[model samples]
Target: MYQSSTIINHIANFTSQRNTELLAFSLLKSVNSMISCLSTKIITVNKKGEVRDHLFFENNHCTVKDNSIEIDNVLRRSFEHMHDSSLAALTLKTKAGYSVIRLLHHDRKSEQFLIINLNEKMTKENDYILSGILSIYSNFIQLLNESQTDELTGLANRKTFDSAISSVFNTRPREHKEVDSERRSPNEIIVKENHKYWLVIIDIDDFKSVNDRFGHLYGDEILIHLAQIIRSNFRNEDLQFRFGGEEFVILLSADNQMECMQILERFRRNVEEYQFPNLDTVTVSIGVVELKKETFHITSIDYADQALYKSKKSGKNQITFFENMLSQGIAKKSDIQGGSVDFF
Candidate 1:
């Protein structure tokens, strides 16, 4: 029912999205519009086969949820035989009509799935049309990723972080950026009273010495290793960004102060114990602050940076909380300084 001009406009709109997640959402919405007879859903899964986010639409109802275990299990069983680059299509005789369901593997590492439920009967012409639409979606996704990802570490770059935080977390004042719920796991949901969104800045201790003693290549490897350890320590839903060089940032949600402390402490310990080849005693200093809806993103980063400064000043390989520093009168709001650490 849609014209060629309408489809081209949708493709243009999808390519303009700033991040991969947004692109994924836009792709589904555009497809749904161009093919009005189809129902669409976009689901993102992690390497562990867990659903991180899902968007489902049908009739006049729409549901967006953080994660669903039952849905994950069902999808896994349904598409267990398909591999990468393969499209699985099926026909179902539902009460509504003779519908078609298509499962598409969007990405391997992320396990993103593009599921479409079409209300029309299957036909050769419809299959060709669907294939063309998916091709456009795939091309746009690749372009978006290239612009947003860090080349070496495979994490998000600073540019991605700047846009992501503002777009994802800073929507409603005092409310955590609710887009996709930003949950760490599908099971972890934000409860108003019991949860806090924490912003953390991680810096490798004395990173200059590593680059100095060993060549830059080895230093680069150390940075890669550090990134791997960080990925292992944090949840997939958490937004992890490599600001530059040895510095990284994580926006995470925790149940409370103790849990927050535990998460950071565990990461600190993990980095302390990891033995990097050709490197001696690689460690990191962390600064953490609970992000509030009213606080500006830059200010939150400064607070976390100040906390990190305290850790580096006393000794590396430790975690410091901004609230604790404030309570102890160690640092004041006006005293926090950004750009003190040399991430380069």
Candidate 2:
């Protein structure tokens, strides 16, 4: 049996977190504390119920091994079974042992599930408790997501970017190195070692003219369409933000400068080719900078902005890198003093 005080404490702890990733970790810790499970993991899935990625995982014993293929197979089977029935939770036997899978939440973008591996079947009381906890967790997540999301674009709001960039600095290394494919799983898309964080600022070229000619409503529609394009082009793990009115920011990881350039150039080309309502064509100017662990967040933004300035000056609908600008003697580093650089 679970204690009321212990449950209440876990609820309070998770609810107190302002960051979504921190909240996920707290939720896993709470589940581990209350349940007698061998391991617990929170996995993200698409609308079709295919497992896309793992958010958090905790193994309680040394004997348990983390197998991505086995987990995906089990989840696929469990999802199919759940769809065929009216069950809230499903218990299935795996090679390691029995596992319990429950749909924690389903949002507009994706669905999240909690999978717990167990040595034996859970008791009725434990199952009931787990369901109740999940209910609370789902509610909290919905509320938090709304607060952090951009109302118009549905991307993360500017305030959320402030918190996310700090995490990038904390986790990524200062120096860049070559990616070692031998050490990484063939299935893994994001390689942590030698990977670098990139910050790109994208601005719709002459967006003010579009608003002036077509009206604010049409301009808003363009933003929405652009956001959708952004979602389709980038990975689900990438952090996208709307810095308000024609400007957007993307934070992603790439193995090297060449890879990063390719990703950004592809996005640029997509934007150039997109057909917009009441418009002949739409184009965007992009500014990119590789983030170093020791660099201040403000300085990084300034560097990207300087590169953006170069793009706008040379002509719009282009991509520019900060390092390239410095090497070519086109841009200078900022003093980090207050005030904005006038573009017009």
Candidate 3:
């Protein structure tokens, strides 16, 4: 009974190895069709531990080629159990003669291996050919990933921004190069879902003072904290940037000028309400504008800047939306007031 069970197990193992070798051979045949001249076979060891999947291509009247000199140094090392089946070109001292060997492991168990012996020689040219073929497509894939991020924030940077805002402003029919308006013009681009995008420029209020009082360490901590807030408040597609020192810019694709203004105001209110160590509260003033696709010039950036300046000039820790072109005029309160916008 014991001998019968062992024999059955051996047969099962042989069948499994043969099946795997057949699959490997089919795959290699497909590969061979693409290459100029190639021959492949899978020499899997059977349950008896002899070659299982057997296919040999040669002129008939063949005896197993057995000549130590003809089969020279190849496959100097046996495969280690720890590794998956791998690829290698091997030359071995065979009974027949020196032949080209490509070793492929069949299974994780290392229970099966494949050795393909070719009647021809494999020069160094063949070894490096496949790698060169692969790199052409790989490099472009790497570049595409780099385009979307600000090197600093790892956030959607400028070029990524160009693509994002184009969705709302419209990617086609682009013509405006100088028009600046109350809403989006030729320069500014806003992504409006139901409405157009609103651009917001946020500056850390009296950030220099924070730097002076607590040192750059604390200043950076504040900056990082504010960045976290920015990340949390916005969606993944909302573009944010560390535009410059103590300044950040964000584009929300879905909101209108009023909605954008309210959003910034809420951020200001949140900052004012939070207490910090060795600090009372920190506030940021923001400027907002709707990006106008038509008649929008690239100079919309400058308009957003002017509005940001107005917020700083009028009072710190407040939200100011761009009305229109500053030359045409950006809206301002009748008088520049002192003190803060009371926390809301």
Candidate 4:
């Protein structure tokens, strides 16, 4: 029999978490406590239905197992049983035990699954309880996504930028040996050793003029179109944000300035080539800086802003690197005593 008080406590624990990763752990803990299971896992898959990452909890402790082949096999089997209309959850009898897999959430970006391993098949009572827990988890995830997302573009908003960069700052630089295994997919471009996090600021050039000439409705359409272009050009792992009104920010990993330049330049060229409604052409100016552990977020943004100022001053539709500007004596360190730097 499930204790009402215990279930209430579990709901409270998972709901209290703000971070998605922490929330996932709490959800797993709650499941483990409520069910008589050998192991539990939360597997995340991309839109293509390939496993992106997973968290495995077994024997009351979290662990990592390099068993991709086994995971793939299990997924393949699960897919086979997914079409059974009467089966609320996919149940498979494996060599180790019986496993129950249920869809926790699904969206345009990704899908999440909850898998529980038990010595015996899950009872209907357990399945009912599990459905309740999944409902709560799914609702929490939807709320979190709405809170972090931009209303206009549907990209992440400025509110998420600080925490996202903090995650980058806290990550230890991976070694050469780790790079190969760290890659999520063969097509992933940003996975490399000795790579650094890059902070990019993209501004729509003369966007105010666009609003003046074509009206705010057309201008909004352009922003939405540009956001779609961004989603297509960058990998899903990269952090893309709409920082309000014609300004956007991206945090990505790259081996060096050259690679970063290639990536950004390609984006710039794409923006230039794309035709917008009632406009002949639309272009963007970008400023980029390397995100360092020692640098404050504001300082990093200021540095990129300085390069952006140069780009707007010289000409529109150009890319500028803060390090390049500094080396060329075109830009200097932001002086707090001089007051805040203004963007044009």
Top model number, TM-score: 4
Worst 10 residues of 2 by lDDT: 60-69
After superposition on all C-alphas, the RMSD of every candidate to the true structure, in Å, is 6.1, 7.1, 22.6, 6.1
Model 3 per-residue lDDT at 113 = 33
TM-score of each: 0.81, 0.80, 0.46, 0.85
Question: Residue-wise lDDT of candidate 2 within 45-120, one digit each (tens)?
Answer: 6676555556544443111111232355657767767656745677888788888988777666676677888888
What is candidate 4's lDDT per residue for 192-235, written digit by digit as tens?
Answer: 45678788999999999999987998889999999999998887
Sorted on lDDT, highest at the top, how do the candidates line up?
4, 2, 1, 3
Error of 3 at 257 (Å): 3.0
Off by over 4 Å in 2: 1-3, 47-50, 55-68, 72-75, 84-87, 92-98, 117-121, 170-191, 335-344
Runs of candidate 3 exceeding 4 Å displacement: 1-152, 158-168, 171-193, 275-277, 295-297, 324-344
Which 10-residue window of candidate 4 scores lowest in summed lDDT?
A: 174-183
**Residue 327 error, candidate 2, Å:** 2.9
Clashing pairs in 2: none
Candidate 1, residue 98: Cα displacement in angstroms equals 4.9
Top-down TM-score ranking? 4, 1, 2, 3
Give the range of the ten consecutive residues with the poorest summed lDDT in model 1: 181-190
Return the clash pairs for model 4, or none: none
